[model samples]
Target chain A: MNIIISNTAGTPIYEQIKEQIKAAIFRGELKEGELLPSIRRLARDLRISVITTMRAYNDLEQEGFVVNMQGKGCYVQSQNADLLREHKLREVEKHLHASVVAARLCELSDDELLNMLKYFMNEEDEYE
Target chain B: MNNILELNGVFKSYKTFALEDITFALPRGFVMGFIGPNGAGKTTTIKLILNMLQRNAGTIKVFGKDNIFYEQEIKEKIGVVMDNTFYVDEWSLKDIERTLKPFYKRWDSGKYNSFLSDFRLDVNKKVKEISRGMKMKLMIAIALSHEADLLILDEPTSGLDAVARNELMEILSEFIEDENKGVLFSTHVTPDLEKIADYITVINNGRILYSGIKDDLLEKYVIIRGGLDVLDDEFKTKIIGCREHNVGFDGLIDSSVLPLLPKNIITERSNLDEIIVRFNNWRENK
Candidate 1:
């Protein structure tokens, strides 16, 4: 519900919408069966094309994050054990992609980057 | 009902100006903003759609029917608001209502009264006596009361203050809730469209520069700024609307080229105004 969209983002608007909805589900911010704004309402609020919003919702449904009900609207899907695991792994994959890009940009060696990551992981464990 | 309005390869000519192969579509349940610089033929296109001016070539379709063939049928479903008042100057708000009510088959008196009250228009005030903003509100009230499927407005917000403009936009967003309705509004105010329009068609010098999803158009271009030292032939050749100042040179470039640019260059998503201005510069420079 605390969605914020940036007009200037490099990602297309529909992709942004799908990502946010997925994030909300993964973070448990959106409960199972919680109703989402109808496609037209969301499009109106965001001042975007209804077609774009429909695409986002369709993608979310395909990814098993939401379900669209005839005449009722879209709702968050109840989390499945396998789907949750896959979703978490996908999130990690995104960060891994970013990390790879950063490592390449900074010319970091594998050893140095692995050591840095391990050191940060230990630092976080100590705090916990 | 798939496309509320469609114009394909449409053309018109005058002694000094011509509209050439203009094409765009407004699907049902969306708002399309028609924008351009002055004398860009926005009004002419609106006139063509209204059948006031005849097109020399191509076709116009409204509600999936040929516009010229179904002129009267199409006109009945269209609610029009022009930049200038077309009502008699001496006619009161009630008088104007009385005159137009007989023309539409589905005119609703209750809905009409509600619109007048909602717009805070005085029934006794003559057309000439009202403020520009009030007059526009009157037009909008009348347009909505007829239960038209499409609203075609030309410069409907030209003179209104910020608050009035916002009110008008809010009303438009509400109007599209029916899903069977659509709006094609022409304006120089690109910012307003950015807030409510689903699609945008930008015209300049009687040519269509871009026409499609609003987000895609914004995504296609980027505005970049950097110190004048980096302004070289490579940058110069790629930029649109390039402007040099004492401190820096700034202009627009295709978003795809952003990754290839030097690191010192700052980039932001180009806005509608920036896009139009840069397009005009690029055309003139070419």
Candidate 2:
């Protein structure tokens, strides 16, 4: 897995790794049962601490993106459709919340905000 | 494991400045970016760690061993790249290799060749003939070729182009693939540290200003900007650095207090560069 972390980015290094790996799994870039690099190997490759890599792996496992087999290694887990849907929904909810807050700050009317959202959604769909 | 490197109540002095009660640690296999303005005792701390300079007070430990007691032993396993190129002007890369081969027990010529190729450095180029970027690359190549557990670099990217800087960062990323390896990268260049530093230690005037995981800084500090009318004396005191103009004031604030900001004020996440610049400015003003 190729991951680059920004020190200046608001996110922590471990979280960056976790998020990237999750995104890869969501995009089907990493398949189920595929062995992920060892925490040590990933740490060394990324030039980060082993603890940071381990934290990312732990987070990935907790989020069900990957499973760690003690003494063996970590591997991509079979994606749970329900869990995936829930995760995606949560992400959309977050975006909606942010958009609403931004709209409120801008003093945009509900109708105007809805129209902007719809326009963006249409653009996204077109891109897809 | 405890910290990979730790200094407890450390004190060192030069004719002009003194490091007072300095204490910090770098957890294993993590890159700790050491930052401070010039004359902030960054190099002094490094010298203490490397036993190149004696400390008047406190314990210095490397990989959990007492630094003074294990100086020779510790030196063997740690790779160091300083700001100035140490080689003679006339020496070639091959000369450097021959000179360093005996110093490191785990030195591998084959690995060195691979690094040289990776950095695209010519072995025949004299130290003085090589560009500044090439010299830094050569130092990094030599540093990584040895199976050192820790890499300590002092201002390795101070004067390189963006491309060269990124290349060095990439090489560092690749080098840390050995789980046991760690990096102590000291630089005033906050942007490069922002790219790869796992933890950051900021020092000023021979004392540690801050030390912790890079995320902590991002999550816990913010830059607030607003008109002078909106900034109260109470709020101003809480800021680490504040600059005022007739138009407005901008300052770094603790994130926890961000909620207390006046409605018109703007609060945003502060990048490493802004944080360091503000910090140094504050130090200078103080």
Candidate 3:
């Protein structure tokens, strides 16, 4: 219900849902063993396709972020904090790699790239 | 992945208009833009889906259940926003919400209130006292609060300003962010669908002319402009619509046959509006 989506974001809809749920779990917004909304309920609430929500749930389950009980519905699963941290770090690395490639393409100097990153990090910190 | 709603070999008749062999599906999580010229059975198709009017023939299924057998269950999961507001004129936003809350088992008052605030709607304002845009926002708020899996909207942008329309699109885009929700947006405004619609089902003269992805619809057809010198018998047959000009002729060409054109003609990408207009015009003459 608190979800936001970007129409122009390169991320696919399912990935967006998956990443948001993961972030929510990581932030403890969704506590371990907490019950998540049913796929039908979430789809209706979000006005999204049930399949898209289902894919997100399935992906989350696969990632050990949630568990689906037969006929009972899905729930946030207990996670290894270390593993989650590693996963998050890997994602950041990939993003940084892409950013560096883009920065290189734009012919940004090391100082310029560092300044831009610092500015963005500071802006993001303010929001949180 | 299954059809949330489908009509097979469906037919409906009015005194002057009819829907013939109408078959289409709204797959789960996919938005199907139900498009057509005015009075071209777009509303009729929606009516058939809701069973507001009985179909003359064929079957309809919602959530893989026969429509007739699961009408109430289906209705409970479906959120409908028609072009016209059906609420009582004297009813306030709160009054409407109060009236509808008891009908949906999953109705969330908190969510409803939040939506009203987000949409900047006043709960005490009478339905008739609100502007058309505000009324639309109210309807959307109600629709979102009901926890319905499918949202069916008919001409939601018809009378709205660009900003309001963009707001509505943003809301819908967010709604579908979960991917479990599907939207059937019926509109004459092709440009809006150009931005958000995943699949398009276009009807004209009680028949489906095109039904598929927006990209495929754009890719499968093209607009070609050139002089009479560039025209030929083979070229004419492939045209969907053509218009004469002082200097030349411009027309729609099936992209599949683009190679058939002589080397000098200009072919450009066509959008939903151009395709719909050309198809309707061609049908009119035929």
Candidate 4:
């Protein structure tokens, strides 16, 4: 796995690792039933604490994105269609919320921003 | 077995110096950084744990047994690499290993020889013939040669170059792969600890300031900087190490107070080195 830890991002190191791994799983870069690197080896390679990586793996397991087996290692859980859809929808809502706030700051009306988004959506089809 | 080493109310006193209420625990299968400035009791705390200096009070346990009461059994499973060497100057690398092998039941000559080769030390060179970094590496080689359950290293990377320091970090990561083993590494090289330490125990003025998870400690404080005009007495009281000059003001503040600050002031996450330096500034602020 290719992972780069950022020092200036303000988030804790473990959280950064957890988020990146979660994103990879969601994007299908990591396959279901595929083993993640052993916690110790990953730490050695990344030059990070083992506890930090262990926490990242544990958080993934807690959210049902992975399963950890004793003596073996962590394996990615197969994606649930409905669960992933809900997660993606929530992510879209978060982005739209930020867009609305930015539009308000620029004094753009709600309908104007909605129309802009619709135009952008149609603009993508020509390229495809 | 949760904690490999524990110190409860450990105190030591001298004519002009003392360590007060020193209490912390190194959890199993983790590296705990014992950090403090010079004369801040970092070395004294390590000495107490190793039973090198007598503590005026409190109990210390190594692997669940009292360090003093079961010194022999405890020492066998503990590997120590301090700043000073205890070997004769005339002893070569081979002679030193031979003399120390019988002390550890789990000593492996294969591991010793391999480490010596990896560290690029000549076995024929006497202790006085090598440089400071080499001597430190030799000490670490011996420490690793014995399969000790607990490794207590005091500033092992200070004199070493960046390459050697990186090597030590890798070696330590592999060593802690076993859940039964742990390390209590005491050093002011906070950057090294930032990369590999699971827990951080900060000492200042001979007292424990913070002891817990490394992330929690880093998340606790933030570096605040702004114009000198922003330095009001009320806000200054909340900061641990407040300072001001003609140009601007800067200090360490608890994150809980971050939201209360004005928009003009900016805050950033603090690192281990900044935390240690700011901790010393706390007394002056008072």
Candidate 5:
């Protein structure tokens, strides 16, 4: 899989690598059982620190999107369909969280916030 | 965790300058950027590690043995690339290698010859005849040929151009492909370190201001900028080496204080260069 990093993205480089790999996995570009590039090789190719790639791989492993085999290498996990759905669900939950904070800032009542959510749903439905 | 090199409370003194409480460790399988402004005891610290200079107090260990005790054993395994070479200036590359080859047990002539060709250095050229970048590459070639586990570089990238520096990074990344090898690279060129260094140890006036993972250190500090009017005493307290002008003021501050900043203030992530400069500025301000 090809991964590009942008220093100007305002996010840390390691996060960019992690998110890109996660996106690649979700897109089925990285198939299950496909071995990822060795951490040092990736760092060398990308001209980034070995630790940065190590961090990204470690994080992916911890998050269950990747698995490490001792002395073997990292590989994309099996059963990615449920994992993919779980990731998208987390994103939706995060946006809803931000919406709640924004609604609280505006001092909107619970009913008003619920009505706004309904309005958005209907708008999206009409577009569909 | 195995440490290739460790220094604790390593103190050294001269007539007017001194290094105190110099402590840091380079773990195996990574690179540590040894950074500081000029005359900040970086070279002195390296010298102490190499046993070229004596420390007044504290301990230094290389490969789990006291540095002084294992000086020869450690020297064989630790490659040193100082800003200048000590090889006879008139000696050709081949002659130089021939002179130094006997000192190393695992001197691979084939590897040395290939690296010289890869660097495009003529084997017949005298040591003083090559460019600075070539000289740097030659040192690295020698370092690698001897199968050194730890590479200590002092200002190795000083005179090299950006392309040369990037090439050096590639070579260094390849060098540490083995998990047992490590590097302690000292340079004023912070951007080079930013790309390849796993950890950073920032020293100033012979003291370590910060020493830890490079990412964490970068994440810890931020650049704060705002109009001079925003420079209240409370806000100023959080800033380091605050530079004030009629129009605005800017300085480095811990990211933890970002929440306390007002809406008018601007915050940006601090890079290694900015951090080092602001630190030196802080010294001047003090």
Candidate 6:
């Protein structure tokens, strides 16, 4: 998995790490049971504090994205269908919230909003 | 988990400078970068830790024992690399190791040899013939060869080139793989600490300015820039370290005050260098 960190970003280093790991998991680049680098190894490689790395790993474990084994290291956890669906739903909810705000700002009717979304979805599918 | 090194209310004084109530702790498996300007008591505190200088007050502990009470035992478990070299100028790498090996109970000859080769140092080269980087490598090789749980270095990268400095950082990062190992290196080069230090203890004018995780220190302060018009007495009162110039006003402000700040002021996350500069400024202005 590719992970890049930017010191200038407003996001804290640990948050950047967590977001990247989550994205990689969602993208299927990191498969279930795939071993992640040991905390020290990742910290050394990234030139970041091990505490920052530990925080990221701890968050991942708490979110059920990874499992940390004593002495062995962290591994990607198996994502059940329900968990995957829940994650996708949360992601969609964020977009839907933004879309609702934009629709209200533009004073669009329900039919107009639905038609615009359909047009964009079909446009994206044509490229895919 | 036990602290690898602990200092409690440490106080020391000299004719020209004094370190007052200095305190911090380094947990095992982490590297704590001790930082300060010249005459900031960084070296004095280090000397106190090694029991080289007597403290006027307070206690220092290594491996849960008083530094003075178990000085010899503590010394055995501690590896030190100072700016000055104690090796004879004419001695070769092998001679240097052979002379110093007897002092440490756990010194590994094989490990020393391997490190020497890994560092590309010739065993036959005289100490005087080697470069500054080579000398530092030799020192680190010796430090690691003893299997010391704690490595204390003062300005180890001061005189080295950029490439050499990066190499040393890589070596240090690798050295902390063992959960029992802890490193405390004092340096003015903040970037090095930004890269690998888990915790940073910044001191100035013989006083502790800040001591905690490296990330938190970076996050705690912000650099604010705006026009001179933004410099009101109320805002100026909140500035940690700021300067007003003909162009505009630039200052350091604590992150907690950001939300209360006027929207016109520009704020950016402060780096370790900015934090040091601001602290130095705050001390100077005070």
lDDT of each structure? Answer: 0.88, 0.84, 0.83, 0.87, 0.91, 0.90
Off by over 4 Å in 5: A80-82, A93-128
Model 1 alpha-carbon drift over 4 Å, by segment = A1-16, A27-29, A46-49, A69-72, A92-123, B227-235
Flag regions of model 4 displaced more than 4 Å.
A93-128
Best by lDDT: 5
DockQ of 5: 0.52
Q: Which candidate tops TM-score?
A: 5
Residue range A7-117, candidate 6, lDDT tens digits: 768888999999899889988999999999999989888877888899899999999999999999999999888987988898799889989877976688989999999
Chain B TM, every candidate:
0.97, 0.95, 0.97, 0.96, 0.98, 0.98
What residue runs in model 6 are displaced by over 4 Å at the alpha carbon?
A80-128
Ranking by DockQ: 4, 5, 6, 2, 1, 3
Candidate 5's docking class is: medium
Candidate 2, residues A23-109, lDDT tens digits: the string is 889899999999998886776576555667787999899888888998899999999899899989998999899899888877899
Summarize candidate 3's per-residue lDDT along B1-286 as a digit string, tens digits.
Answer: 5877788889988788888999888877777888888988898888888988898999988889988888988888888888779999999888988898888888999999999999988889899999888878888888888888889998988999999988887788777765577889999998877656778899999998877766567668888998898777767777887887789888898888877677567767787888888898888777
Candidate 5 per-residue lDDT, tens place, B1-286, comes to: 7999999999999999999999999899999999988999999999999989999999999988899988888888988899988888999999988998999998999999998999999999999899888889999999998999999999999988988888888889888888899999999889888978999999999999999999999999999889987789988878888889889999999998787787667778889999999989988877
TM-score of 5: 0.92
lDDT of 2 by residue, B141-208 (tens): 88778877889999888888998888877877776655567889998887767756778888988888
Contacts from the true interface found in each model, as a fraction, amount to: 0.29, 0.50, 0.03, 0.65, 0.65, 0.56
Error of 3 at B34 (Å): 1.1
- lDDT (tens digit, per residue) of candidate 4 on B94-188: 99988999888889999999999998999999998988778877887888788788999998887778877887887888888777889999898
Candidate 4 residue-wise lDDT, A2-118, digit = tens? 788987687778889887888888888999999999898788778888888988889889989999999899999998998788778987998899899679767899889989999
Is 3 or 6 the stronger prediction by DockQ? Answer: 6
lDDT of 5 by residue, A56-113 (tens): 9999999998999999999998855677788899989999998997787678899999
Candidate 1 vs candidate 6: the TM-score winner is: 6
What is the C-alpha lDDT profile of model 1 across B7-82, one tens digit per residue? 9999999999999998999999989999988899999999999889999998999999999899888877899988
Evaluate model 3: give its TM-score.
0.70
